[model samples]
Target chain A: MQTVKMVITGPFSSGKTEFIRTVSEIDVVATERKISSEVEKIKESTTVAMDFGRITVDDDLVLFLFGTPGQKRFDFMWEILSEGMLGFIVMVDSTRPETFREARTILETFKAYAPTPYIVAANKQDSPDAWEVEDVKHALRLDPEVKIMPCVARNKESVKTVLLELLYGILAEMEKN
Target chain B: MALKGNLRDFTITQLLNLVNLARKTGSLIIEGPTDVAQVTFRDGKLAFARLGQTDSSLATILHLNQKITAGQYRVIKERAGKMTDKELGLLLINAGYLSQEDILGSVQQYFIAIIRQLYTWVDGFFRFQPDLMPPEDKITVRLDLENLIIEGSRQMKEQEQLQEEIPSLDMALKFSERPGTNLRNVSLSVEEWRVVSYINPKNTIRQIAKANKMNDLAIRRVVFSLLQAGLVQLARPEGMPVAPVTSSSSSRPGAAPLPVTNKEEQKSLVNRLISRIRSL
Candidate 1:
């Protein structure tokens, strides 16, 4: 049996777990704990360790999805989760502009760890006040070639689109090699 | 739907860039914690702006600019209360009290000032009402926003860099042990001196900023300069409670560090993944 790994990461509450759950065939194994930080009152609980999900493309090819915790304290897990990954997705809350800076930092850090294929998923696009994908791209200071896809993690179609975009990016990199 | 969001998530600079790039025509209403601002644009060009409930009338602007005397300003306020800005401006121009250029220039300056003030507002709610125009009676100008956008973008970049350098305003600052040069010999700006005077291990950068009447950006800039000069370093505020460490476990801990796949194997795997995703 062959398994390919893909990691999902972003700032706090950027929908990394939801994105995984929306597509994962099995019940995602999430290590969630009550949030203790006063600043993160937006959510009741946050992923403490990581989220594990899997998709069986076929009998022989299974895909693994890992989501890293978002808090700065859990930054050590980023490198560990990123290891041996085929590609990664940097999710950003489209309605929250303040997280854009952190999103950029996470992207840079992941890129530095491994020059792997990745795409930014601007999640929460369903919100009325959500920033446009182009605006999110500009705010993130992303290069022209870096794809930023609009996503709503709860919506399976949107999640699929984001995952497909990242897969295409990986395929392109593979073709180049 | 109206375009609306908090300033925390989308800055005034980014909003302006969007307006300019999209050539949007509307009124951007920003509600700050204490005040409200309305900026009008036509074809993406700045036309007018008003802050709070203050008088942004042509006569008031002229008076504030010293184009009119105090007595004239008082009389105009008393008698021209019913006149619209356009009517007042035309009346002034006809009476030779002010030239068209003077009125337009003053209005432009006032509008720009309002926009500049908006930049300092980090926490606010802004909503763009598309196709909204300023009052018909109000005088408007067609000032290009390109320069303002450029200036704002530059300031935003500087502020971001400063914030990155000084991640937390709650963090205190302490003078470096080895300055390599005497602090007394070093030339410092008035703002820098003020910040330095408040530099104590007990006083967080936020406290220093509050004492000096400096905003987050100002304090960060000052502290960042001090840090770059080796004059001060960030330290935990005295007696502040430390956060408890939370350990995280990574999945597949004992897995290989790097993907162990030949080009052919990777290609086949990617193709299979792509086919599966596309079908989904």
Candidate 2:
């Protein structure tokens, strides 16, 4: 089977684990109760640091999906974790608009280290008051060619739609080569 | 066999069973890793998922393939139990244990867990959509009333005469229109199309590669082409297949109003960064 590596990089509790759970073809084996209470007082548990899964787009190919730590302190670790990585799904929360810069920094870092393609999933599109898709793009200053999809990370439909977009982005990148 | 209420009160496996039986649509929101994940379902079939804010510069995820110890995983859960997903992702990323790519990968997997559990929870007791918002972190999803009493009695008699109708893989595949695609004329390399054909909407790439001797990388390239062309898709795994007859839910009085908790948490860490920015 041909495999491509993709990573799920986002803030803590931004549905990294859940995203992995829903898109992977097989059942994901998660470490139950993987968290610290003291941390809980500061944050949420459920999927503390990271999660893993894979997607089969067809009979011959599979994407090795990776999720990273949700905390900023873990940023230094990404260089090591992202070696030979194909692309990334930058999970964003439209509910909170202040995080635009943080997302940009990570993308800039990627550009500096590796010229990889990426797609943005403006999650929580289900929320009644989510920022407009255009507003998000304007805020993030993303490229028009980049596929930034509207989605509710909780819904498989929305998730699938975005996956197709990112996969396309990956293919587009490969085509450029 | 029936499925019941939302998964806030049930385990992962339990939730998936409910999804399969109801053939419901919408998304299940799981508050894991400090973020709210929405996994969409149609006719109780798995659809798609995403994480983080598409608009933000701070938005990132884990590599998804890195395996963690139950203990370290516990620390994340405990920390995220209190903090918001954004807070947690930033915390870990800054802490230097995970990368943005890695987090994205994990976010995808966590979503799969919610989808899988929907199958396990479908035992005729409760009925609920994982996508709907619950009144509390752990609220009971009241089942449909009329069917609960009626179906309970009917099950005893029906079991004697009924043989469980199992759906074939092809039938389940029908849930996705396959985009009614024709792969011809596309600029596919022999290696790329070989990989693309393997990335069926229904199976995982790992599963496909296991069946064939192809390297996962080649297949991934093709899958990307199909995805770009809108011919195939990737979704969380729905539970085991069942017959055409969907399940029922119990009737509960109108749901109580959910408590107001600030969905967004304080960006203290980032706040510090922001403050530093302003000072600069």
Candidate 3:
């Protein structure tokens, strides 16, 4: 089967790993490390390396998903991971209004490195304080052509919708190219 | 005689508590695998901290925390050439980016953060130099070492438990055939949910850790807690080969047969790691 690399990336706690975990047919491989800093107050560990997962779609094609570490210190991992990627997904945590800038930074970094078709998944939309899709779009300063899908990453259906949206985007980009 | 020893012979936690309780004034210098750190104590309180090259600069921390933008960081870096870390912090305050209190708070946090990382090291050498004061020019942030000892020890215990429970990185995780006996009250965290979702019979703890962008210790802790909750169990014994799931040209090569857990093997690993650190 032909294999395509797809990257899922975002800032801290944006649900990139969770999204991949939700969709991956195979078990996801991750390199999580204990966070010694104040970030540990929020979460026990952070991704220092990359997250890997795979899905076999039909007999003809396979999708390999790689999730980048959220911190800048691991930006080198992004460079290594984005190589030969078909497309990518950028997730934004809607509830973390302050993190929009970081998410934008991640999106820009991915675009610069991959230059492939991509869509933004505004995750954690189920949270009470989660920004509206429109608000997230505004916060991220996304272009009109860019698709922003609000998703609850923990939900299988929601994660599937996000993946399908990216797949369609990839297909469209491939056709254009 | 000055107190000095390898960490294998003396626990850092005990040393910290001993100094704190004694109300000693000294600098505890710890040399780890790659870098060295000095923790200055004044009458039992952690007066200040200094670390070797591996420690991230204040600007880097600020940038990472998103307190400063990339442009601002570059400008700060260019402008603060030759300035000490303390001076750079003061500059941040003078530039209206951070207040004095904020800078002080960050200093304390930054020191504690490095100390937290140091606490994780199983091998290192330590020396307590008596009657040495912290640098007068540096920003001094005092901490109650006893409080730090309590917190650090708790975290260390958790880490120990994780390592003890999941000794081998390659152990596979499988969900229990019987659902955890107590169901209704047990709520899972987002991380737990992610771990649970990826619990295929074939994936080892190491692979799961990699896919989740987590270290073995973190993954092991999750798996250990799940086991305690009766949510998951080990699928295979240590050193057993799970069927290789990789195709031809796969990035993952088979795990090399690990050396038996003997003193010689450990000595070899330590020597290899030290050389690796030196090369870096």
Q: Kindly report the fnat of each predicted structure, to 2 decimals.
A: 0.49, 0.00, 0.00
TM-score of chain A of 1: 0.98
Error of 1 at B197 (Å): 12
Interface RMSD of 2: 23.2
Q: Is the docking of candidate 1 incorrect, acceptable, medium or high quality?
A: acceptable
Candidate 2 per-residue C-alpha lDDT over B157-263 given as tens digits, one digit per residue, 9 for 90 to 100: 33222212211212111122565566675576766555555554466655654455543333444444555566655544346455587544322232223222232
Write candidate 3's Cα lDDT for B34-97 as tens digits: 6788888888888777778654566776676667789988887898756776888877788788
Candidate 2: tens digits of C-alpha lDDT, residues A40-155: 34344554345667765446555667777666655655655466666678877665554555776666665554566678878777775566565566556687676678878767
* Cα error, candidate 3, residue B247 (Å): 47
| Candidate order, TM-score descending | 1, 3, 2
Give one clash count per candidate, in the order shown: 1, 216, 16
Model 1 spans > 4 angstroms off: A175-177, B1-10, B69-79, B92-99, B153-268
Tens digit of per-residue lDDT, candidate 1, span A1-177: 988899999999999999999999999999999999999879999998999999899999999999999887888888888888888999999888778889998898888777788999999988887877876887787888999999999998898888888988887887887
- Candidate 2 chain A lDDT trough over 10 residues, lowest sum: A40-49
Full candidate order by DockQ, most accurate first: 1, 2, 3
lDDT, model 3: 0.73
| True lDDT of residue A76, candidate 2 | 59
Better model by lDDT: candidate 1 vs candidate 2: 1
